[model samples]
Target chain A: MKRELTCIGCPMGCRLTAEFNGTEVTEVTGNGCAVGARYAREELTNPKRMVTALVRVVGMERPLSVKTEAPIEKRLVFDCLAALGAVAVAPPVRIGDVILENVLGTGVNVVATEDIGG
Target chain B: MNMKTKRVDLLIIGGGPAGLAAACAAREAGVTNLLILEREDALGGILRQCIHNGFGLHTFQEELTGPEYAARYIARVQELGIPYECGAMVISLSPERRAVYVSRTEGIVAVEAGAVILAMGCRERPRGALGTPGWRCAGIFTAGTAQKLVNLEGRMPGKRVVILGSGDIGLIMARRMTFSGAKVLACVEIMPYSSGLKRNIVQCLDDYGIPLLFNHTVVDIHGRERLTGVTIAEVDGKKRPIPGTEQEIACDTLLLSVGLIPENELSAMAGVALSPATGGPVVDETLATNVPGIFSCGNVLHVHDLVDFVSAEAARAGEMAARFLSGEKTAGERIPLIAGNGVSALVPEVLSKRPEADVTFMFRPRAVYRNARIAVFRGGKQLAVKRARILAPGEMAEITVKQDAFCESEGELTVSVEEVGA
Candidate 1:
């Protein structure tokens, strides 16, 4: 399968075109550099992404926004958000405070980015 | 038709970090008569809306919020009693560096300057500009506007949100909305990876558990009265949405933080040559635009990721503009700046013809790299080289090429970045 992939891994926005002979990769072009090629291959085979969103909070003005401690399985973003919906944090939250421990049993802790004053 | 024309030793446009710093620097450099014109009523530009603390970590060695960081310099501008006009919008610039400004009550006013600094910062890109298929609705707000509404105006625009684009503003807003009692449904990015800093990705989104939908886009906006929901689809390798993968996510607001374009209409009207790479005026090391008397710096020269760098660059432009007014002469044989492979754009579009000075160039990489080498060449002869252990598009790269490379020689200078060993 011949495919074109855009390298959005960073600000460069590299345009990449790739050729795959069956399940094996063949050639890549239009990439400004090699990292784009690597991104394209990984993106085609096993795409990964960092997830961010919000969970409910008690005694606070609004919900507490949170993100996975690290990159989770890219395919599980929806499942992760579903899990985050039921989670909630209390007020007087400090930046870098852990809101959830062992999120989805992935050993990743959902943390807070900003301090919430009570 | 004779407008009120005032004369000043130096005139700086836009009252952002760059403009304020430029005015102060020029004043300290023995230029007494200086004027700064700002369109907004306030002095701080985009920084005013950024309520989150994280700024001044590098420059001040302490973390400060955007307004706090701005106040530090604004205080200096006040202490120096710098002359400035708020609510003054510069409509045009002459080739000779005269600024035409208009205010509601003041009407049309023109200011002739011995030197002018163009500090007009950049503007955000909206969803309509991306050619993305979506209904034009009331819920769409640029990340900055949304930031202004929530952080400054103290108004909650929506209770449920869907953000498009993962730039710093959008990413930061994802966290902000969650704190503002809104449910951020998801952040959709058409690209496979994020365009924001690693720290932001980790700190802003990861901490909040906000769903950042990567390689996805909002194909349709569902509400007509207000925002009801959004249709998001997974984009393939080519960034086109893959069919049968559409997922409807319920949301009331759609925030766009796609990108920024330098606000350079005045430069354009003045006939200053612009670089296609950065969409800003082509400037020499002195930050002088193609038009000798008109100078530009900060985000107006090129979009900068950090405000500290913007201030530093603007100070240089301010200092050089004062020198120009004091009879600093430019020699012939100015070298035009050219971008090389793996390099998106280079600033200070021209290099000085003299040998004793050092000229700095800020650039963005074309892709992510583990080990890279940035090299500067004149007429195909390598002039300067620097090594980078890691490089990413989110970060800006600065390199200074020695003035000697262009002193004795004349021609185009090319700045290229390449992966090590490749």
Candidate 2:
């Protein structure tokens, strides 16, 4: 099987292609640098990305921005979003505070990305 | 060989918003001996290609085009009489913060400085990264490069086009193509939501009658010598193209507006440690990288979504770089930077150990939110919190860590967010 992916490891976003036989990748091509190849191999097998978004905040005109406490498995991004929907936050907020304690059994918490005024 | 190298108080690289701001700030900080180096004959980085308005909303409190926004800084730099080298490409950078350059007139020279600022900016993602099956043809170009060709070079790309990725550049190009007598067939995006701001979707596409295909991606390209057409597919929950759903769109060109990546070859060669999250060097509040005398700012640190924010961030780095050179800041101790929930990345990748000043960290959210709470923590203790309104993937959020918070802390500093009210 042949597959192509953008390297999420860095913003270089190296558009990479991998030739895979079953689960093993045979060849990788089309990156500006070497790290692109490494990213293709690693991500093609096990992809992961930092999940960021927002959760509801108290006493504000809009939602409080949020993201994963840590980079979860790439396959779990949507699932994480679903879990995030069930969570809520309070106002008098601070930057770097976690909104959800443990999200979606991933052990990764969802935290705030911005600050809310009291 | 007697190599007579000039030691300056400050040396700045890449002559963009960050370099200009750094030069100005360094001068203000009392470092009169300064020099800025630019690779291009012009000073602006990506701003030169951006012809449409909508910049400077935050920093300048007015909407301006890329060139117009850049002109403000360029004029300021000029008014300050800051010395700069144009058409000078930096060949290498030393870990000790020395800048090496080469030009047509000047064969080679090294500028040793008390402090150095890296502001090379970013590059666009290309077709190779997207894995779209197609012939490598002439009609394919990154949106920014195409913009430069048309807006700056006085040339047209093609008559009809298909654009991949709903980034700001792609959206802007959609409008630009229409204005330049070309018809944009459609704008396709793999993600369900656009990566560009809400206003761009309305002004660039909606106002122009360009169709936007969400959850769609270009699966194949058809062309021999030039672009002729492309096959687009609808993506499922996993964002994989659905078989049999491919539709071929006839066109002469493909414009990729996927994303931007920080240009860090010089930083990498200089041995500056970079954050995997941002793909840029980690620095402290002073914008100084781990290598004490070396500093960084602007798109070179991270791919900023807005040019206005880039200038503001770069100004901070410049001020810090000037302080470093003037003996106002001495290396004390440094700490690690931590990212919490709903945060994709952080700047000033590292923290200072004996931090005497505050540090501002920038990051992106996970998805759209109605009400969210952003908070900072250290050693399992909450440090500060702020409320947010309507956060999206297209926008970047900034948070500041007070100097008082770092005064007695010794562990990892974390930034996170939570949803408050629905």
Best by DockQ: 1
Q: In DockQ, how does model 1 score against the reference complex?
A: 0.05
Q: What are the per-residue Cα lDDT tens digits for candidate 2 across B3-76?
A: 44678878898888778877887777777888899989888777766756567889889655566577678878
Could you tell me every candidate's TM-score relative to the true structure? 0.78, 0.76
Q: Which CAPRI quality tier does the interface of model 1 achieve? A: incorrect
Candidate 1 lDDT tens digits, B1-422: 77799999899999999999898889888888999999998897887767566678777997656666787888899999899889999998988878899998799999999988999999998666877655666888998888877765557889989899899999989877876668887888888767787556755676567878889998888877777888999999988889999999888888998999999988998889999989899887778777877889899889999898888888888898888888878545567778888888688777656744877788898777766898888776877899886677778887887766666555678888888764
TM-score of 1: 0.78
- Candidate 1 deviant stretches above 4 angstroms: A1-118, B408-411
Cα shift from native, residue B73, model 2 (Å): 1.6
**Candidate 2's error at B179, in angstroms?**
0.3
Candidate 1 C-alpha lDDT tens digits along A1-118: 7886556545445567889765655788888778878876776676554555556667544555456657776667667777877777778886568887877777788776545556
The runs of at least 3 residues in candidate 2 whose Cα sits more than 4 Å from the true structure, single-residue gaps closed, are: A1-118, B1-4, B408-410
RMSD of each: 9.5, 19.2
